[model samples]
Target chain A: MTILRFDDWTDPVRPVKRDVIAKLPEDAGENPPVLFVPGPGHGATAFAEHWLPHAAGRGFAAYALTPRDGGKLREHVHDVVQTAASLPRQVVLVGHGEGALVVAHALGRYPARAAVLAAPVLDRWATMGTALRVNPLGAIPAVFGGRLRWSRRQLLSAGAPVEAYGRSSRLVTSRKPVPKPVGDPPALVIGSPDDRVVPRKSLDRTAARLGGAPLLFPGMGHDLMLDAAWTDPIEAILDWLTKELSAAS
Target chain B: MQDTPDIADRHDAICVIGAGAGGLVAIKNLREHGFAVDCYERETSVGGAWNWRHDRSPMYASTHLISSRPLTEFPDFPMPDDWPDYPHHTQVLSYLERYAEHFGLGAHIWFGTEVVSAVPVGDGRWDVTTRSTGGGAERVQRYAGLVVANGHNWDPAKPEIPGEFRGQVIHAAAYQDTAQLRNRKVLVIGGGNTGCDIAVEAAQQAATVWHSTRRGYWYAPKYLFGRPSDQVNDRLLRLRLPLPVRQWLYRRTVGLTVGDLTRFGLPAPDHKPYETHPIVNSQLPFYLAHGRITAVPDVTRFDGAAVELADGRRVEPDLVITATGYRARFEFLAPEILDTDADGRPDLHLHAFARKHPTLAVVGLLQGDAGVFPLAHWQSVAIARWLRLRTTDPVRAAAVQQKESTRPVGGWSRTKVVHTRRHWFEVDHVNYLRSVEGLLREMETSK
Candidate 1:
């Protein structure tokens, strides 16, 4: 339940005030803790709270990154790696939805104890096209930081589950080459076959690049963690962890 | 200590069972003193329980060494410094491989060989028989001595849960990974360390994880004061602090950090702390506190997947995992040769030597909180030297027999691990180690 703030990665020389939220474990020990990266615009408290408590209860020190005026996709990735490296040892890094892309990008430099990318926004255009279909006025941006500009009201109210919305405007213009995961035995990607947000092809590609199959529950959708059967995805991750860890050892 | 003159040469080979941790160390110690040793392992690999995929491996997915690396590593050969403090099961097996290779124990090891039975004749000799794993050949080789290094965990101790459990039930020994638990509601029976570990994993993967315990258990964190808990305790023992002071210190530490079990809805432990084996789980209590996992009473009965608790509540789970402990078994040896109490524990004099037969020695046979590796190492040393000196020095052998100390082992009570069924052999690490030191010293000191 403890909240910790870490320096933002976008301004590494003199990072900004604590924009990230992490639940410091009561005790940190041999087993490394988990670092969670929520999708940009959606603060850590709103999105990452769902599983951080679960991780803590299971005895892992849990963390959540909150990029308020979220930066470029790589900046988010840099922030995740920096935070993980700062920890005592390698940690399990989990990113949800668009945040999954950040985690996948981070995996190239800092291979984690295990990486979980859930419903990634791999091909930015396709993901934005899918979002545009839902909100023509709210075509979300792909990059964050000061590159792209948009009104706060327009970005925050986009239709998403539980007030957890990602700013599409902060992403549109800063168009550097988007990072695709070149993961060796890639990160454990979690995708939804029935996801309405991220395109099916993008999700499949994410899994294929990661080298492990996507854990897609039959009836679950894009917001698997917030779904009534949320336990399904969590369980899959746990089962996958058992295999991954045993293999890593 | 110099090896005694042999009536027979190295041709008088000693037969060893199962190339497990105990068996490997036993073979190495015996070979160190010039004993011709031929070890048998049913599995091709040298590491026994640490070999995850081996059929005999009872290790679950989340298994890590309860004891730390430095403390658990062998005396002469240490684990790689890069290994984590509490190395995972795979790391442990690899360490064992390195140990086997370093000591050249693999040369005399007969992989895919299983000991069928060991029978001792009237005199101090044994008829050892072994069969190749894949129906290759049966060899009945006579040996001067038999070292039963085969551990006690092979036999699954299935607690008879009264009533019908129509749902899928599995013993923890049979559990391989978490695949079976995913997308299913699981109920874990028993609250031992294994049970707690499996229950914690089940909570993460299963639809709903329910934990049932017969009674509350004392819990020990993996580390204390930035070091492994066992190492800290070993230090405390080295300081030679009084027993009461140590117990008091431990009770205070656990009470302060872990807090009361009743606070987490778990029943208070029936016995005092350190009375039995404390559950060495660092996570189970946390989950229990958050209500992520529901703790229930010992099961009264089961109807299908539905389990009725001692309290009237019933839960219909998809899978029921019995994380029950194992019973000590010596199936390969003659039942009559080793006498026992009412329960099945072999009534031995020094936890290693047989009271009736001098030819048989069960090394590393007892349980202790301080990693069994060091204890097994010392026990093997004592047994090897004792085997060498018994006939040569009768008075010293008698002295070794008479030097039985009231060792205070964690989880020694008949009611704890053994339950009402049998006596669980618990070895106090300090006392047993000291007594073995005394035995080793006596072996040297005697004329």
Candidate 2:
């Protein structure tokens, strides 16, 4: 059975367990904690303010990953995936914006019960150039500044159009496609109709590529979890997770 | 002349009317071409449709622009990266306000001053009359040339129903917000974007919602494959194919034509194919797909709490919203200079020069699958160039007008027009801009 408890990563952090779940109900024993991945300039605090209070009221053991600065993307993903793997029960991953891309990478390594991708940047190369407003070339140095290094072949394999960047340039090539999960999990994709940064068409394309995963298109701003329109869809996702976990149990 | 005030009040240039999307762009173009220009606006703020508030404003609840942010953005001003993909009304307004501020357009604009009349003077000029909304003294101004950018949507088209329904009936034009619709059953009439959005908002609040469409329509969402479908549609519209062929190709690429709304559980419309409202954003179809909204046929009669459809089905509703569309009202403009088509739109040749008068031009009257801002801006530039050439070389201006006289009026005709009834796409926007640019460039070279 899944248990909910607060564990501090930082030494100075307070050890508070305000709402701990000792054990999941027998019916929901196989269910996992809903891990929220936030967007840029946001962290767990934002999730707590916008979604967690209401989610907690609805019987969800919601948890947000604390934001880390100057960390390698793969390392962070590995840490989160490792923690989720050690859990007694399966877990569902929910991510927004750049966090969505991170979750997808992590999912490639470790599959989850299900995933809810809200405004995720699946095509990192295209997204870096267009959606995120960062210089595509500049993003390379910033994201892989330290220990992490991406070769041109790796970048080319990861869906970056090699010819557009330059055929001769070795460092600018795409990364290899992340390996697909053995048995694909059902995914729920949510996006804003008014999301100016991500092309609205991308949301549908992402859903279609996922083999007819259910989609929740809301006429809202880019921030899905914070928007009032998300209430119904989030509830639906949690309920679906609960039912699936209970059935497995 | 007995020292009359009317004779003493003669002015130098012609008046440009209505400082909305069309007017602002036109004025900027004229100023760029070094033409002495003055623009008059009825609204207190700049951003025409954008300036109109959300609550109690016709543009409230579930309204996202069909145009891509890139294409919808004004020239030289990209939309902020942090904004949502489809910008809200407030964002659009702020963008427009910024456009005006960036161009120093405020000084040229006379706000709260309604143009009462524009009588053509015999010598290539117009006698203009204006009344301030604050009840100040009426003012008269005249100019060398006039451009009408007043735009459409100020007047609401109320459908002529046979009987009075007991339910509260509201026109989509006057609809401010959805707060009044909470917990009530709503019947939203019309299949246009406004009607679809109203239905979506109503479904979120009301106990139930019944959307009435006069005909079936294919709705392309704001995006496709994570890119703006508008961009795709815009590109398709610009191909060198014939008009009919282009229409057919457009239907195929956009996915599903009329009578296809049933797949989404939306009712097929029953009305004759008239002019379709351009640019219905994609949000409404998703709402229908979720079963939050139900679709029905046209309203034939109203029976207090119940409404009878043309299909002979009846349903009761607490609130009825007629998203039936709007008419272009230029009653304030003098009848002599303002000539209109059967549908009440001003008849202009090439959407810049009026068929009735040469000195007076009309911008923003042309509405297609493309956005009006870029088109209006470009047309204004053309008009300004044409005006400059006319003053410097009258012979050349006359010859150009004679050449254009043989061409058909406007881009899309009522009969030949293929109404996608979808929002503006980037491809269409680029093509239209290019076309206008080409036209202006040609005019410049001719001079």
Candidate 3:
């Protein structure tokens, strides 16, 4: 009956806790706890299937936080913030798609050890503003004001965003400039060239904002986590995580 | 004549030759029509000219159907939506395998059995003699109907290039893969799809590549504005217009002119109104634009390692590929029944029944730049119905045969059929389907 299921290293016997962070194998003795925040329309299940099994295989005890009630962006953000507040070790945050933007907003409040933003959905206004130039005039306003606004929060929760979400969200949002490091944690960003749904240009801008840790693949589609070549980027994230966790220790 | 088997001992029911696209369609159609059809395929697999891995096949990496997925697909089976807009050779082969499996066609398929001779018996039946490549004893079979779906491309025709070159020379059919041509200067002779594809692939690994075409060809894209161009062309050809006028309009719309090739960084040949490749897909020009491939004039002579072009240019190439077209050879049939005119295609009636032999139906022979599956499907249906009538009512069969025999045989001329647009062929396919459908409907209604 269950369409998707994956193995998680943290708390193998008990059901996953909503607030507690899980420690990766590499983070066992003195490693930093890395929290994997789920995107809009997704849950801890997706993170388990897409990220945890692979990440745990690479020796990282990654924690995927569950979604909260009402399932709004504000509530989920509060959930993530509440979960991060209790972690004893210095936390390294990892967000995918729109969850990257939420991490960006949340990082301004709760400083993490390091951030890994995979295919981030940045500013909606600047993103859609650019798309409206090529898009037909009649569909511009509604596409920008109504669809783009609602989809960004949805995409942040869901691992994948609609095509309109990529176009309009890109038009309205400007690139978020990388802030001065409060904790000197290195951020790694990865994307695919063949991603039609999420323009590689947006990933480039996102990488530039994070001081250029971009890893681009040619034939891979929009779903980077599902790609066969995901191991390279995921390994890079673990390597960065290991170095950071060591330095923190 | 110790123990030689007499040809008369062969059993006859239905003999379908060539396991390519057309042959499979004919077999499937006849079986569906409740006829005990036995298909004789020279090759080990079904997929006609579209099949790869056959030693005699000239199919290349870029070989694909020019027809859109919708039109190219069998009426009963639609292509998968997840498949690319223009399916590749592997995809096409997989689809054919699926089609064969769905229709239970393999049990009837006689792989490695080459039809050596097909002689007509006295009572509207055929005596078919087959030889297995395994050196086994010859097997002869008799059938009530005979369908020649052997297809057009059986013999590779190489251009007459004077003097023997010391370098390696191979026909497109013999080209297995591109492993040997790495870092070597390659000369790909012929401007058709195979030549272009070879030139492109060779350019990627080879030091350099020179593509030679005797004449300029109009390169038609598989898609126009994100849709298959054949879809638009098919609609246009169905409008009752003079053949020449229709061809002209088709050329203007879908066909890429010489200037268009220049824009894509390919050299336009000096010759006018060139021939296009029958199989449509090739990524050569795309690679050419990126400086991976170079175009040259036609070859006149080969002097040891160097080759001299008709345009007075000379270049040395380590390997030469002849992408020259193929000739359809039916050696098994009698010379009278296997009649060919000036253009070399067997003289047939509307490309279905042979003019000299009304009892014999030839599917997949008449190609006009369009996909042959639909045409072959319709032809099979018509042939099946005709056979059904022949069995049910001998009097009507005789009358129809008498009427058809009175009609004058048409002359074969390549020049006449060459100017025909792809869309014109689609119109023929549609018309053939409708005619066959109408005949089947009439037969059903009367019953």
Sorting all predicted structures by TM-score, with the top scorer first, yields 1, 2, 3
True contacts kept of each: 0.00, 0.00, 0.00
Models 1 onward score TM values of 0.60, 0.59, 0.57
How much is the TM-score of the A chain of model 1? 0.74
- lDDT (0 to 1) per candidate: 0.68, 0.60, 0.62
Q: B1-447 in candidate 2: lDDT tens per residue?
A: 112256324455546787777888777778756666788887787877667752213566445676655455443233453456568877777777766764567888888888877777677787777777666566666678888887666567788888878889989877777787899889999877777778878878888899887667656566655556665554444444555665566566555432256676554433222224344556576677778788787789988778999889999998889987666667766544566645555555555577667788888765555456656766776788888888888887787777667654233233333443221111233434555554555566431
Write down the DockQ of candidate 2.
Answer: 0.01
- On lDDT, the candidate that comes out on top is 1
* iRMSD per prediction, in order: 18.9, 25.5, 27.6
Who wins the TM-score comparison?
1
TM-score of 3: 0.57
lDDT of 3 by residue, B73-180 (tens): 553343553456568888889878766764557888889889878887756677887888666677666777789987667588877789999999988887767786
Residue A178 shift from truth in candidate 1, angstroms = 64
Error of 2 at B302 (Å): 1.1
Query: Residue B230 in candidate 1 has what lDDT?
Result: 72
